[model samples]
Target: MSRKKTNIEKEIRALKKRLAKKQSRKRKVRIVARSVISKSKTVIFDPCAICGVREATTRDHVPPKAIFPQPRPTMITVPACSECNNGASDFDDLFKVYLSMQATGKSEIATRLFKERTVRTLQRNKSLLAKIKAESKSLLVENTEGESEEKLGVLWDSEAHDHVVERTIRGLYYHHSKKVLANDAELKVQWLKSIPEEIESILELLTEQVIGDDQVRYKYYIAPEDPRHSVWLFDFYGAHYTSGYTEPTDS
Candidate 1:
């Protein structure tokens, strides 16, 4: 072969070697990821986080992955049964829509998720849209001048919201305590936009700490003796807030 032909062959061989190295590195990274996931699953052994009866067969993200930006680096997962894991998708979608509508400009993540996931979900599930529309109502409130003003808002589905809250509490409880909650433990949920005076006093009595940043923050207070009885406060986008509590069934 001529000099130019030999040089071309050598360059081609060099490129192939580089490509092979890149592919091998990618395979190694994938193997590591799988190993991490497997180890995480083994770390928690418990019944379903929701019903607390059946054995947990699947690991579930505390907040569904759909609510977060693509490729969320560190997601919190909890032990869960198949039903609790899969059944919450519709509620999660609805919650995202409500959160996005309320968020508007406060959170870039919420805005992007609204456009990408919520809108598409609404378009696909016409019944969900109708349900939301049907539940919407208007109320008349008096102004400073004693004039009635119309206020409009969507009526939230309490059952669905409660489901999300309960699951989240269970996940956080396990994440923090590294112990499964009792199967007979009862959870009480209350959705609040601001901390009630009573709750504030209770928080003062318990341990308090904040997690995450302005975009998403969790301010929680857990009783030292019984974690099941605790207060969880979630702040999204530094604007929307939802607070709730879980207590023993008898309490």
Candidate 2:
């Protein structure tokens, strides 16, 4: 009986050891899974991922920054015009439709709707900004082949946000300097071809910064009814176009 008892004790000890080993393996597997998930989901921006501007730019949302109230908001993005950013409020209804589609996992439909609304908005406004550039052979013309090439329409692919930002930047640059408008415009279009890699770098940096800062809220802001007129300054130069962005201290 004593021998049998000793044998049972030994069996129990072996079972516990095996259980512990299995648990350790499971824990390791869980850690690996979590790591992969994090790497996959974390948004990484490259040289110009969100914006696509090669130099002197700030990140802008393709969906418009004003969609969310503040503090912590998530939306689609690209490098954008200060005009685009400030004017985002005008796209409230369209964005709501986009949000609905996202919630429903109807991306195809959402894409179609977004494109349609965008085209309509551009058309109704009669901005003719692109047309003016094309007709005048302005620096904003993007590219030209002795005026024989097909006039490039604003094309929005899967990377619509990035494309929009790219076009806007080209337009802004062209407007700023009529001398190299055509060359810059053409170069800008080609620049987008390599955007996938660039975005990865920008996203990685933004993520690291966000993770490092525990205090500041990383979110978009909607300007009040009357936004500052200076926002238009981005239509020409670098991101820090404003030396003074402070709100009024008191009335």
lDDT of each: 0.60, 0.28
Candidate 2: how many backbone clashes?
Answer: 21
> What lDDT score goes with residue 28 in model 1?
8
Per-residue alpha-carbon lDDT of model 2 for 1-251, expressed as tens digits? 47755554344333323323322111000000111225469533222322232322455543243222223334434443354455445444333332322322223333444355544554575643354334432133333364544432332222333233333333333232221122111211121121233223222221111211121112111122212100111110110110111111121
Which structure among the candidates has the greatest lDDT? 1
lDDT per residue for candidate 1 within 9-52, as digits (tens), equals 44433432332332211100000011122645744345665556
What local lDDT does model 2 show for residue 41? 91
Candidate 1, pairs of clashing residues: none
Q: Can you give the lDDT of residue 208 in candidate 1?
A: 44
Q: Give the range where candidate 2 is weakest over 10 consecutive residues by summed lDDT.
A: 25-34
| Top candidate (TM-score) | 1
